[model samples]
Target chain A: DAGVTQSPTHLIKTRGQHVTLRCSPISGHKSVSWYQQVLGQGPQFIFQYYEKEERGRGNFPDRFSARQFPNYSSELNVNALLLGDSALYLCASSLAGGRRNEQFFGPGTRLTVL
Target chain B: GESVGLHLPTLSVQEGDNSIINCAYSNSASDYFIWYKQESGKGPQFIIDIRSNMDKRQGQRVTVLLNKTVKHLSLQIAATQPGDSAVYFCAETWSNDYKLSFGAGTTVTVRA
Candidate 1:
């Protein structure tokens, strides 16, 4: 089976612009989560959706939002992007929402804010 | 505030040698601990995980040891190989929570 997959592996945006990244979870997975990874740092959780419902959210600002589809695919959107928003956006999928399930990650979309 | 942190920023080891990486977490309520390996330009891969009920867990050639008393966690790789070179991160989360808190990763470099 294929792992989690993401689209537009690379993106470049300008300050004050908006960008959207997409993720397709593994087959039979029900939960999808988004994380932002800065250079030299670990991934920071952004949002988690289970069964198409928002189950968790991280410390990110209002500019960041995400939603999951019925098929378990997810989209992460960033509005009014800032230079600080430049990072790799990762998507992970799991069988469920809680800690009992191990998450499988995607290759991630590298967002560069110019 | 709960947080997870690593003891070292980097570790260099020779091939066929053993490697150890350490992490410390401040959340005593966290019952699940996981280790992830991330290569450049890719997402993290699950290495191993342990629950608070157990002190140790092993997977393939890797081992994860947990010490709840000191809130410490360690990952040990036996006969490390060059393919093991990557940034390793330790994450913690409670059974009731949906989020996983990650620490600053430890970069492992295996030399041939």
Candidate 2:
């Protein structure tokens, strides 16, 4: 079924630079979410979009944002990246009808901000 | 400021032994809870989930127990194998919405 796929399996950026990571959800999924996992910590929610509308957001700074395309794919953008921003950016997708449903995750993009 | 958290940072068990991983969540409004397994360089994969209405749910070789009284959650792995070694996390969702909060995660290592 192709599952979930993420782009730029790895990325290296300098501090203060902007970065964009992409994700393609599995077929028949309507909900997309973004999460950040710092080293030795669990993933923290960033944003969730359903039906192309923002459904939820975490406590991340305004510099972090995301949008889901009409096709259900999503992109996560970070502006003025900091060293702390160097973490795994994960994308998950699921059916939106069943109470948010069970999210299937992609391998994620390892972002390293130098 | 209350969030999902784990009791142990790491757990090591011999193969074929049963293992239990525990978590605590603060939000009483949390109606749905899930357990996810993550491997090195990969994202979290849903293992099993249980709702507040139920105290326990069982899947393949795993079981999830939820204790609303203590705001606690636990994942139990039966007859653990090396493949079962990974970081396990527990997450809770607010009843008013589906926003999820994950715990710090427990690393499970199965000894051969």
Give TM-scores of the second chain, every candidate: 0.93, 0.92
Runs in model 1 lying further than 4 Å from the true structure: B1-6
Candidate 1 chain B: worst-modelled 10 consecutive residues by lDDT: B1-10
Candidates in order: C-alpha RMSD to true structure: 3.7, 3.8
Query: Which clashing pairs does model 1 show?
Result: none
Judge the docking of candidate 2 as incorrect, acceptable, medium or high.
Answer: medium
Best by lDDT: 1
DockQ, all candidates in order: 0.79, 0.55
Interface root-mean-square deviation of model 1 in angstroms is 0.7
**Clash pairs (backbone) in predicted model 2:** none
TM-score of chain B of 1: 0.93
Candidate 1 global lDDT = 0.92
Using all chains and alpha carbons, the TM-scores for the candidates as numbered come to 0.96, 0.95
Model 1, TM vs. native: 0.96
